[model samples]
Target: MPLQKTLLALEALDSAYVNGESVKQLFGAYPRVTVDVMTVQGEKGSTDFVKVVVPGSEGKRSGGQAPTMGIVGRLGGIGARPSRIGLVSDADGAVAAIAAALKLADMQTKGDTMKGDVIVTTHICPDAPTLPHEPVDFMDSPVDILQMNEHEVLPEMEAILSIDTTKGNRVINHKGIAISPTVKEGYILRVSEDLLRIMEMTTGQLPVTFPVTMQDITPYGNDLYHINSILQPAVATHAPVVGVAVTAQSAVPGCGTGASHEVDIASAVRFAVETAKEFTAGICSFYNESEYDRILGLYGSMRVLQTAGAQTTPAV
Candidate 1:
């Protein structure tokens, strides 16, 4: 089960001094996994971007042509210290992403490597600033969205599973994990049935899906209201992106303390791990290529939505 991995990630992140080096050490035992840590500075502060690469047997890293899947633990920060204490709700995405990486590393050690490579990226920030928002405050990241996309959204990733704690909104009222529709370029395609089947098989419950708007899929810093940063990766790459959301029955602030639920985070971890397995093996399809081609041929391209539209007013 992912319980152990989730616990391990939670323990690693619930620290005032947690950084990329400390996180890298956790994967030293798995030689097949390579971990890198780079410090990125933003206007407000700095944080370490921790990237974990688990090369699969037939994956591109090994000279094979198997597709690569990116699993990004998208979040503002793990903690909003000085102003708040302890691991906040925003930490769930990082926890889930790291936990999934740990689990994949362990599987590799046990001769359970998949067919494609998995690239996992997340930041380590113990103390970050908090920002004012509508229903609840957000845990501001040390780096802004552009910086985050530059570091996390690597071109090698053909498709991405962007996991984030989506409990800060009233739109999605679920207790476990929910998935979003396939977002590619600028179109909000239908939810992948294969993903739904996998989610049902993994959780043994109905697959829960959250909504996404045109503005939500666009890049951040656009002054538009987003459900959260769950879909930020979509704006940075042409890859088909899906959001794995750790949810709650009620709204919770991103900076709220002691609001992280291990079970819920574990659920997201499991979902991501399963998706990685299927996606890498070419057994899962995020969207039908022929159907997508038909749409493009009929209506033309919708790439404009990926950018901040022709300037009318600056984003505040």
Candidate 2:
């Protein structure tokens, strides 16, 4: 089947699975509760970026309890190239079908791109169950509670500060999460609502505008969630042939259990896509010398297929 057709079919399957009265009612009342698929073109050597901050006094006290080591503070960020494929759905069944179709398409078009046969999949979920029942809040920035110590410094404000050197001088590591001056809490909520609306639509829907400004963290915590949104590719295959590649943005920290499941799924997809892209690139490079024009011809043919509606797999 054509790639577009396959996607439509998968979407139909998802709709059917979610069509029960209970699900319909739930969706009608709270459409944001649904799951959505987001896909990106598979690429090789993709990685998940993590930034950490440890806490300690800036001045080294000659006599004090030795500073504690080990990940005092850790934060994750998403890392991905500009090109990718994705789908979104609240229905687990639609997600499954979309995943299957993506897997099949990757299998069929393995060598078409620089990434080998790979389909990167990611699912966004909430960070904590106790905070809210909404699943789409995965993209939201929660109000951080400030806990101060005797010195008035946030006691466990471990999210922003890290200590590197312990012996003489304390090396404080500070990474900023950029916040937009114009965007307010209300604006953020509206963006989330817009995303929910898009999620209810078809599979290939792309966000008209990305609300998050910078991909990197800034001086404040505003960009924390944005940085964490980086997506990595996951690799899944049978035997010698890679089956699926999953990729997604970085996940939030200290979220509840339900949100963790979504993080795992997204991580798995990122790994798959990265693996496939790397493997394919290596294979193509190795064989290019012998095949020469022939390899180029194959690539051209695949491009045409992709353009002509063939279910082209991702490039390895």
Candidate 3:
């Protein structure tokens, strides 16, 4: 089960001094897995961007043609530092991502390799800023959204699963996990059937989905309200992006301490690992390419939404 790894990741990350190198120790035993960590400085602060790659037998690293799947732990920070102690609610995203990578690495060591490469990217920051929001506060990142996309979203990724703590809003009230509709090139596509099937099998219940608005898919700093940063990756890549939300029944502030639930985080990790397995094996698809093409043919590209539009004049 994913519980062991999930708990292990929680312990590893729920600290006042956790860094990338400390996290790298978890994968040291696995020879096949590669972990890269970089310290990037931002105006507000600095954080470590950690990338873990569990390569498949036929992945591009070995000159194979199978597609690459990306898992992005989308979060502002694992902890709010001086303002807050220990891991906060927003840390669920990073914990889930790290746990998934650890589980995949372990599976590979046991001779269970994938058909395509799986790249997991997330930042490590014990201290991050918090932002004021409607229902609750949000954990602001050390870097802006653009830098996050540049570091986490890669071209090699044909599809992406963005995992984030979406509990700071009243939009969705599920207590475990939820998925979003497929979003690509600024268009909010339909819920992916393949993903739904996987979620049902994993959760043993009806698949839970959250709403995605035009503003949510648009880049941050657009002077608009966003449910959360869960789908912000959609603004950065042409690849189809889906959000795997670790949620709550009530609005929990992203910066709230002692709000992280290990069981819920483990569930998200399980879904992420399963999706990575099936997606890389070519058994799952994110969207219907032909249908997307047909819609694009009728309506022009919505890519303009990916950028900050021209400012309208202030009302008199």
- The numbered model that scores best in lDDT is 3
Scored by lDDT, model 2 comes in at: 0.22
| lDDT per residue as tens, model 2, 1-316 | 2234334433432321222232223223222123222211112221111111111222012232322111111111011112111222111212322333243344334433322222222221212121221222221212221110111112221111111101110111111111111121111112222222322232233322222332211212232332222110000100111111112133222221121223223222222223233333332111123343454455432222111133457599
lDDT to native, each model: 0.92, 0.22, 0.94
| Candidate 2: Cα lDDT at 110 | 43
Q: What is the lDDT of residue 45 in candidate 3?
A: 98
Candidate 2 Cα misplacement greater than 4 A, ranges = 9-228, 232-316
Across residues 208-272, which tens digit of lDDT does each residue of candidate 1 receive? 99999988998887788988899999988999999999999998999999999998899889988
Per-residue lDDT of model 3, residues 1-316, tens digit only: 6989999999999998999999999999999999999999998899999999999988998999888999999999999999999899999999999999999999987888999999999999999999999889999989999999999998889999999999988889889999999999989999999999999998898999999899999889989999999999998999999999999999999999999999999999999999999998899999999999999999979998888877787789
Compute the lDDT of residue 123 as modeled in candidate 1: 93
lDDT score at residue 207, model 1, on the 0-100 scale: 87
Q: In model 3, which regions exceed 4 Å deviation?
A: 314-316
lDDT agreement of model 1 with the native: 0.92
RMSD of each: 1.8, 24.2, 1.0
- TM-score for predicted model 1 compared with the true structure: 0.98
Candidate 2 vs 3: which has more lDDT:
3
Q: Candidate 1 — number of clashing residue pairs?
A: 0
